[model samples]
Target: MNATDRTPADLLRSALAADPARPLVTFYDDATGERVELSVATFANWVAKTANLLQGELSAEPGDRLALLLPAHWQTAVWLLACSSVGVTAEIGGDPAGADLVVAGPDRLDEGLACSGERIALSLAPLGRRFPAAPAGYADYAVEVPSQGDRFAPFVPVDPDSRALVVDGVELTEAQLVERARADAEALGLGPGARLLSGRPYDSWEGVSAGLYAPLAAGGSVVLCRNLDLLDADGLAKRVESERVTRTAE
Candidate 1:
């Protein structure tokens, strides 16, 4: 990316321009033995589709609050960017009762149902399959997202200075989000094409920085690992060697 990039979406656009074919986010679920890798173009497509789903189907608008009740998985990362693309404020672990919409994992089905607005349930299953049956009062994300347009254009332009994210009571404008991410990238010594292996959840500032924003700001890639506690040190070392990881953050 560049110093001028303001939002997470801006960082993504830069990454798409710089290396569309390079792997952007590689995911690993140690307990489930699941591995998925998305190139910039592929990740962009997922973001576009999910953004369409949010805007067109859920009627999500700029400044709308989205409660992200999900684990640190690849799909959760996609949802975060999709919210940013549509100019929605991503609220990490926010209360469903206060949110305009809720995108939830299986474990949070009850919390999702409590939300009066739109609710989308992710199977978080392999290949992003739909739940056997939709959760009560919730749309199955895997079912609805496939038919949406592959290209996304926001109905309203996102303002870089507008509130874009809220994590654990801390609100940040898009510009601030990018600025902190870039600073974190520098602190981590990330350079162009750097590959990072991050075993952190996105519930806090440091985890979000390491797992998502930092890599984008630095023009790098991330290998995001969930259930990392299950991986032995030797196994993780082997993965780092094979994935050519340039840096690591726990």
Candidate 2:
């Protein structure tokens, strides 16, 4: 881990600086037969745009709580980093009623509506498509995110020591998150160039660590699989070989 990396966003920046073209996130949805790969640069770009949307359009300030009701998809990863970039406290599967903002998938719109603050809904469709009919009282993420600036510059500096995430009622500051990610990386035997395939969901700290932070802190990459149980043993093995995965967490 780089000494300069204090937050997850910093880790992503370091990864982008080291190798813009290197694959950082490879996502698979076995239920949909969808595969999407994002290089460090590409992932950073998405984070930047989403960060801009959060900070500019949504007027999100540091310490603001954002209830994130999304699944373990690439876009969910993007939102996590975006929240880190702007110092928003992301709450995975958190109650929307108490949040400053709510970001949800189409299936979670009803739950998200409990938040009187800003609300954004994602289609979670292949290619990030827009909903045929936009959900009422919530902005369409796929429609709005594309128009956001490619570069994000926070009006207020993010504090590395500020709360950054809450998973399963456990709160972690940005610095703590980085430290834990590094520790998890070491425990998982992840090193440089290590590729970990994770079939875990995003509701728990372990799942978040395996799917995003651990490999990131290790200067490696992750193959995030959704609905992985549906894949046969042969198919899973073939995928491991094809993706060059060195480790797995399920």
> Ten residues in a row with the worst lDDT in model 2?
1-10
Estimate, for each residue in 177-238, the C-alpha lDDT of model 2 and write its tens digit: 99999999999999988999999999999999999999999999999999999999999999
How does each model score on lDDT? 0.91, 0.95
Off by over 4 Å in 2: none
**TM per candidate:** 0.98, 0.99
For model 2, name the residue pairs that clash.
none
Top model by lDDT, which number?
Answer: 2
Clashing pairs in 1: none
